[model samples]
Target: MLRAGEPGATGYREALEALCRAYWLPLYAYLRRRGCNCHQAEDYTQGFFARLFERQALVRADPTRGKFRSFLLAALKNFVADERDYAQASKRGGGARALPLDFGEAEARYALAPSDTLSPEEFFDRSWALAALQQAMAKLKAEYAEAGKEHLFERFKGSLQVDANVASYRDMAADVGMSAGAARVAVHRLRRRFRDLVRQEIAQTVSEPAEVDEEVNYLFAVLTASV
Candidate 1:
């Protein structure tokens, strides 16, 4: 995000574009909670990115102020509030080149708890935290795959957050063909590595490293609420 802070920087677009690709879902979820239908949410999500590029959002973005996710949410709010942009976004064809976001399963994936009704802002935070967790887990799985431990990751990932609910280490070790103590240590190390990966994921969006811990705490809080 430092690229966004730089004046006339070459990589700012790439940096923000990466963010757009990775986090479009949260924005979509926000729009949905704001009363948009599936198609409308998809349009607004893609339209925001299209307008983002058109307006040079990176130049106007100041990461020094706060987290990149906040900037995106605020910018998206502004975009949705504009009557002209809303009208334009609703159009099926207006020479608006769409961003390559896959919305095929967007509606299907959006399963809000029947008992839990959330405001748009709450929805955004919940979605944002979930997105970060998903990104972190994906990165961790990729790392494990590179190390020839993909199967282990799949088996142990369920126990990443809670150990008490899982089977005893002896049972897991017998299933995985490892000593019980080694299995316990392996899961311990996996949990530690996952924490580091999650922190790294949070660090990517903030200007200062100090903001990472706050963001991480907030992320978990938001996710826990959804549970």
Candidate 2:
């Protein structure tokens, strides 16, 4: 996603930082799954970002090629392959201009992932999908908060992409101070908004607009795959 443009272009730095924030956990988890201990994995992940910035590796990306995640994972695998020592990386990683990660929270979240024999790549794909969904949801929630409809958002969030089946249209309509028809319309609008937000989120992780739906479907498949 951050690899969409030239290295020194406007907003490139911010884009890079955002991408790092969205993905560092998944990368760290992949490293851990590959047999790296916490400290080693942390070092490797940080150092990889550092290298990306320092070397401007993103400028080498060819948008016509493939998904951003695949490009990134390939780069990371190469980085790890070339690194001679984790101890040295840990020492140097302190000076790397990488995004800060809350290791405690990251490890706690990783602990909740199903531990049934998944490969590192499989785990990374699932984690990345979850992260993308979370970012979209957070953005949607913030939009409602800014509109002074935070409570309404909370009540209707379950209807963003599903019927929920917990309440009838009339029942939900009463809770939201709307008639059943209006409530149904509200639900339809929210689902469309959510779908647009998801598309936007997926678009950022791809090289082209046409790839967004393809990427979105792949991510959902990854999330649903057997652990």
Candidate 3:
């Protein structure tokens, strides 16, 4: 985040893009929960980011305030309130270049959200947690694909957060043509790698290295509540 906060610094744009990509869905989810239709939500999410860059919001962020997630939600609240007249959503983003957000699939994902029991903020946090898990899982898959082990990763991925009994490792071994013991060992390695990736995802939003574990716990709690 500090890297993103400094414009023209080495890696600044990369850092900013990473932040944008990770949180865009959560922000869109927030808008949807706040009663915006899909089109309004997409336009608002795009406009918020455009305004963020225009005003140098990142450069002015103070890590002392709180986690990046909270800061972003607060910023979004302000943006939404200020743009209450966003019937003009068409005009707002028509002139600014947009971010590479996956608005196409965003509504499909939002359709699977829990029934309207959660507040907008609660929904945003839940989406954020899920999104983090997704990003980590994708990165893990990509690593295995690059190593020519996509089949192995896919076979054991369900074991990443489970115990030694990932349904039936013996069956997995038979399918993958490996010994049962080898499958168990492979699953153990996959679980270890997945935990590392999850931790890395948590570490991104926090101001201090020590905050990752607490953030991870909070993320799980949000997911648990939704379930």
Candidate 4:
């Protein structure tokens, strides 16, 4: 039922909402990394989403042009460039509105990696990928927790990151108190779940399901270049 290129149609609002939910964290991280203070970043992030509700912007979005993340980042860069001074302006009618933001978490994540060599576009894509992965992992962990396999999820999640010297299946199995076969199975399942989640994440922003692989490859390239 989720057709593309119909921003004013009955399902358009729902589709856009889903896209925002998937990308908000990455956009926030990009803003925070670009030297915006926590409050300014929060406002800008909220404002960016608010602008998407504009008929002009939504109706003009062309999925055929490529990845929605790219379109969004470009829009955000233009928005910031255009609104450079608005963040510091005094309010006329009342005190500044409180923009809802997860400042604590944003600050924590930013603090962990305060520097990067990637261009703004690359950084945005990298952040997008990370956010998508985080959301997918959270959902998977919750499912595991609900099924009384929280420990298993915890053990595997720790090793999801790519590393040149990653431990072997036998080593991880020993560390997690599971047999090598069981560890291998768990890791395989986790990888499959991660891939499915990534596809789902990409599908939300794209007009066509066939475009998922292309977006996924671009995401990997962005992450690689950023790192």
User: Judged by lDDT, which candidate is best?
Assistant: 3
Candidate structures ordered by lDDT, highest first: 3, 2, 1, 4
lDDT of 3 by residue, 40-116 (tens): 88888888888776654544455334587887888878777766666666676533555877787998899987786
The TM-score, computed over Cα atoms with residue i paired to residue i, of candidate 3 is 0.89
Candidate 1 is scored at a TM of: 0.88
lDDT of each: 0.76, 0.78, 0.81, 0.69
Q: Which window of ten consecutive residues has the lowest lDDT sum in model 1?
A: 89-98
| Cα lDDT tens digits for candidate 1, 24-52 | 88888788888888877877787778877
RMSD of each: 2.6, 2.3, 2.3, 3.8
Candidate 1: RMSD over Cα atoms?
Answer: 2.6
Query: Which residue pairs clash within candidate 2?
Result: none
Per-residue C-alpha lDDT of model 4 across residues 33-119, encoded as one tens digit per residue = 777777777777766666665644544455446667777787777666656665332221012332345657877876675375766
Per-residue lDDT, model 1, residue 13, is 70
TM of each candidate vs. truth:
0.88, 0.89, 0.89, 0.78
Q: Over the stretch 104-127, how does candidate 2's per-residue lDDT look in tens digits?
A: 888898898889888999988888
